[model samples]
Target: MSPDFLLLYVNDPDASAGFYGKLLDRAPLDARPGFVMFKLDSGMRLGLWGTETVKPAPNAPGGFEIGWPVGSDADVDQMADDWAARGISIIQQPETMGFGRTFTALDPDGHRLRVYQPALRP
Candidate 1:
């Protein structure tokens, strides 16, 4: 089965909405004191919530993160450069690994996101 949705726990909903909205170029579909929802154009859903509202995964960093599989290595490189230019922190540069081309970046709250393109098509 395909992954259906993702939720991110944050300390501040407004700040997270501002950060994500600007990055995603869209406003949240649902907004509340403790939660926000962004309907990603990629057909997935992202839910943001206050830390107090949900239980964290055991030993997890307890935050939100997102990654998109790009079309090619060039796309990955361009995306990394573009995000870096926007002042987003690049935790890892695009590089070839066993998994294929990949890079890692962090959102405002220090959540880790890894973007990867597979080496071989399914």
Candidate 2:
């Protein structure tokens, strides 16, 4: 089966939802005190759940990153700049790597968000 949804442990779902809403340029499809969700253009759903209330409490918020891919190296750079202007914390500047040009940023909950442009395959 394919995974179409991702759930993240957050200190505050509402707040995280707002951060993600602005970053993704989309509103949450469902939002409550302990949980919030967004539907993406790729048919994927992102869910933010309150850390204090999760059944199996998570050890931390940023064990993994949510990776985003863009069309071109310029697009990756553009997005990084846009997010920086929006007051988003950019922990890494855009740089070309083995995979492509990429940058890393942190969300309110310290979750790593990586935006990249893939290098051409052989």
lDDT of 2 at 87: 95
In the range 18-71, model 2's lDDT, one tens digit per residue, is: 899998898899988799999988999999999898988888876658999899
Q: Can you give the lDDT of residue 119 in candidate 1?
A: 89
The most accurate candidate by TM-score is 2
Reference-based TM-score, model 2: 0.96
lDDT of 1 by residue, 86-114 (tens): 88889899999987998998876688777
lDDT scores in order: 0.80, 0.92
Reference-based TM-score, model 1: 0.83
- State every prediction's TM-score relative to the real structure: 0.83, 0.96
lDDT of 1: 0.80
Query: How many Å off is the CA of 81 in candidate 2?
Result: 0.8
